[model samples]
Target: MSAARPARLAVGVVSAGRVGAVLGAALSAIGHRVVATAAVSKASLHRAETLLPGVPVLPPDEVALHADLVLLAVPDDVLPGMVRGLAAAGAFRPGQILVHTAGAHGISVLEPAVEHGVLPLALHPVLTFTGRSEDVQRLTGACIAVTAREDDEVAWSVGEALVLELSAEPVRVPEQARPLYHAALAHGANHLVTLVRDCAELLQREVLVATSTGSTDESMVGSASSTSAERVIGPLLSAALDNALRHGDRALTGPVARGDVGTLRTHLRELDRVDPELADIYRVLARRTAHRAVAGGLLPDHAAAEVRATLEEHR
Candidate 1:
């Protein structure tokens, strides 16, 4: 394949999942044809229709047998067995490009397919996919982690070429580093969602208290203002996220960073009354935040010690 553009190969997506269908659409946009896909779930079938229209839905073996490039976008746990099963079924042929999107795995998991003389590559797009057209658009600036045999420059170039064709940058990741790379991404992206949702839930509770009328349930809060909590916090959260990305540890702020031990105690008591689990989570995160603040010079060691003491006393 050329560095500027990949050849228009016949592509087969092993399954029309959130990641698979959107990637298929990206490949198709760049002149490659999506020949076949396997989709069993209703959502998958709908995604195939929406993102990869005109592509035939076939069994996994048939999809692999018919394509020059096979994209295995299955879950991490399912990928190894699926590759082995396809190789055993004689579906993978010589000269076929076998690719997987599992972030934790490198080309090692493709060993079974490699035994069949197929060129194995791992191309994991770092962004989350929703099996939508917008997801294909998101690929334009997203980073894809490319892992091929360290000895094979041609294979590495091929993976890089494919990512470039989608207008995305490719970062070369060594096989041994794949697990840690994926873990870091998960810790940032996945945990960020959980953290944001927890914050939103807490804000919603306060919204309920501030806006209650004759009724005091959550429905009353919704009736008063459906998006009041989100409206109040969205811009602040967005700015904090942007600042954190741009400034790293220097972006630390709020009561924990200031070592407001009295404020921390009040928060813990309120959270403990409302939800013990949430209180525990807040305590743990606040303790860590205080440490980071101190290390970043936002808080003095004496202040951080006081914050930690307050958290432990609350526990």
Candidate 2:
């Protein structure tokens, strides 16, 4: 029955990539037997050795053949071909549980394996992974996007149950919405990394320049400035993120939100002088932020017009 927890499954991970290795370990933690994993490349092999000690590393087809639950954790583009290739190889069996970790795909991509009568489900963990042991702990309280056939309640339950077994919350995503869902996550999480890194690099450059006047060795200065930059920005970025989450656009602050055109001009000039590309990025994002500030009623029409004019001047 759908309400029942999955019986202990012989789990087979198709590859020990970051997502695969971590999810395999999570399933193992929940008492599933990780019979084997397919890991190629030095990194993947090392990940398997570290995260899944004693598990046999085999080829993809062999791994699938050895398990009752086969996890396909390959890239989104590789997923369809892998599924079809495995199915053609007769690696999937009837009544087997076939799951993929590709966020952009739903059960549809598993159709080839489904033709073999496997129970197809898409269980995409919403967390980024580093293929490390700590990732297993991060699974707790994380959201996993679960997608099953619209009419298949049993499949839905199975997907959610698997997420629960990993100590994660399951959020149902309609098959049609997977692409947009994945895009939204990528836009936020991936772009946030770029944004944070840019900020850190700029801060580090400034710190290095300021500290260079001292007798400190160049390498030592660089190292110290990098750490100092992180220390300076960490709490500020954390609070900004927390406030944005809690207060929505009302959390908007700083020059853009205040519609301080003079301050905006200064930022544009500084960035353009030091990092022209970053200045271009700032202009684009500041334009968007200004729009949001106005929508949030934080900026008046006159002030927003001035801000827009200043940005255009910098462009």
Candidate 3:
């Protein structure tokens, strides 16, 4: 039997932060009434104004008093304190849904509110937020990592129903696995931006070198901000990501995969001059990639040995 959905919620966001504001708007879209939210910063206020519109900006406690579902989308570090403070303040009541969006935490972090007969849920959307209206639209087709009390079927059902209302899929994450789940997502998504941008900057430097030496590289026209270079690089990155996803470790390619010691040495020399930090990053990633390639049988044993030796020598 399908578990019964919770009452039609009156939502309250503790603060109209990036994730909070967009999610508040999403709930509003799904026929929930967002009565109030707390927003202090100018950015948060702006986001609330844009996303929540006519919803009143109230104090956290007042917002809590007005809503049946309290969305606590604060930073991970701030969440425990916030929940304790709100509970101490008598802001939570019996049967209130206390949902936090911090990926690193589960319902244990909301334990303080459980004393007030509140239902705790960890509803973490496994996607990035830009605090824009577009983020509301982005919620569709997204995966939400839902962590609920294992013994409470009603809590799990309510969490999944909320996710479905926002047009997202729900993946159950056990309370014990929240930290590891969050770490994996952060390692993949956050570091990916750093990796991609660094590669683009490195390519921009090479393009500058080509142009300064009097070469007519039409592709090198315009600033790094220009789509000219992105046009050349973006498709390559997309294809590489697609291949990596579909084939996993077997998608190995490039100088590291080929075990081109000379090419790697040249790259290290150039990058060392360009950015010492980048050179260090490149060396570490190349070594790891080479290891994966060998493990996947993409690189021969001899090639893997040579690559390892080259990396160790450079280090």
Candidate 1 vs candidate 3: the lDDT winner is 1
Estimated TM-score for each candidate: 0.94, 0.94, 0.93
| Local accuracy of candidate 2 as per-residue lDDT tens digits, 105-171 | 9999999888999999999999999889999999999999999999999999999988887889999
Count of backbone collisions within predicted model 1:
0
For model 1, give the 10-residue run with minimal summed lDDT: 207-216
Q: What are the Cα lDDT values of the candidates?
A: 0.91, 0.92, 0.89
In model 2, residue pairs whose N, Cα or C atoms come closer than 3 Å (at least 3 residues apart or on different chains), thus clashing, are none
Indicate the worst ten consecutive residues by lDDT in candidate 2. 207-216
For residues 1-315, could you state the per-residue lDDT of candidate 1 as single tens digits? 675666789999989999999999999988999999999999999999999998999999999999999999999999999999999999998999999999999999999999889999999999988778999999998999999999999999999999988999999999999999999999999988988888878877765446655366768656776556667678988999999999987899988999888888889989999889989989889988987898888999998889999999989
Q: Assess candidate 1 and give its lDDT.
A: 0.91
Better by TM-score, candidate 3 or 2? 2
